[model samples]
Target: MRGFISLLLLTLGLCLQATGMAADKSVIAVIVTNDNPNKSISLGELKLIYWRKKTYWANGQRIHPINLPPDHPLRLQFSNSILGSTPSAQNDYWNGLYFHGISPPHVLYSDEAAIRYVQETAGSIAYADACKLDNRVKPLLWLLPNGETTTNPSFVNCN
Candidate 1:
């Protein structure tokens, strides 16, 4: 009986740890500088911006899109949502566009870095784990892992 209890406790602990890790991927914030005029963005516009199809904001400032590393969970979620494809698959598209002077979003090392980049660069945008957000940037959209906006804004209480 003692051995069985110990095993159950160990399993529970591991399961909890795994769930905590996955929680970070549950919600993401599409962030931009507070000074950016746009209060909200649409899914189609996000797709165009990330794809480099939309080179400038409506205000005429050039758009600068930031990205996290290819395998990062936040980035994978953003790419799948905004680009409608996986990071690896998008590489092929970027390669073809390379000859035309188009480049993929600049890659940063972490959500913090991406946020910092967006804050410092006007007309810039990036996605980060919503829970990690700070006041330095504004969130244009709060998205689920599947790329859909959260139905209830109150449910996403980002700091």
Candidate 2:
């Protein structure tokens, strides 16, 4: 009986530890300006914009979708959560668009660059760690590990 009780306690402790570790992982927020005077974009709409399927905002302004580096953690998270695709799958999708004379969205090397580009260019959108967000741009979406939206306006950082 004593041994069983000890094992149970150990299991509970491990479960708690695992949960804490997962909670520590940062949630990334994809942001854009609210002042664009365009309709709030749905998840599908956002995917279309980022994938280059839709190239213009409702105001007829050209949309610029900024992307993270191929191997960036936020990029992987964005691909999986927003596009329901992997990095390779995203590449394939982009390739298909490129081969047909359609251009994919422009890619940036880092989150800082993406943010800077968005800040400088109207009708532009980008993602980054919530903690790094500044007054330059506004947030559009919050991505979760399970592909769900978060009500929290901040990004979570596990590191």
Candidate 3:
């Protein structure tokens, strides 16, 4: 009976640990084409690019920033973290920019589509759930929940 109780408690502890770990997987993987010359981008520069205030890469390639739909969880997290606003606030920002002939980033439906778009389009950038990332494109930044950024994927703690 003591052994059974120990096993039950152990299982419960592990389940709770797993739930905590899921929260860590929320780190956003900011990806770019494999051929992109940039290996790292600061959060501020990323915001500029996404906002269309910075129009070109260091090599003079035009920057193409992509976004997920407004309702996507990753999008919400990204907007709050990198863009420094809620998704709705971002829409309003864009709405005003529309009259100035400035458009928001193109929206992709899924992480896979974003990955593929980044892979196929030069000078493009997008974010995906770190765990959902494969090798199609290289991750240039890791946006952590703690408001910090990392260029190293090993530091992302995806598991």
TM-scores vs. true structure, each candidate: 0.81, 0.75, 0.81
Rank the models by lDDT, top first.
3, 1, 2
Residue pairs with colliding backbones in model 3 are none
CA lDDT of every candidate = 0.85, 0.76, 0.88
Supply the global lDDT for candidate 3: 0.88
Over 1-159, each residue of candidate 1 has an lDDT whose tens digit, in order, gives 999999999999999997787565658888999999998888888888998899899999999998889888777777776677889988789999999999998999988898899989988999888888889999888887655785345657555
TM-score of 3: 0.81
- lDDT of model number 2: 0.76
Q: Which structure among the candidates has the greatest lDDT?
A: 3
Report the C-alpha lDDT of model 3 over 1-159, residue by residue, as the tens digit. 999999999999999997676465388899999999988998889999988999999999999999999877788779878888977887778899999999999999999999999999999999998888888899989988776788877866654
Q: What is the model-wide C-alpha lDDT for candidate 1? A: 0.85
Error of 2 at 118 (Å): 0.7
**Better model by lDDT, 1 or 3?**
3
Error of 3 at 158 (Å): 3.7
lDDT of 3 at 126: 93
Model 3 residue 43 distance off true place after TM-score fit, in angstroms: 1.1
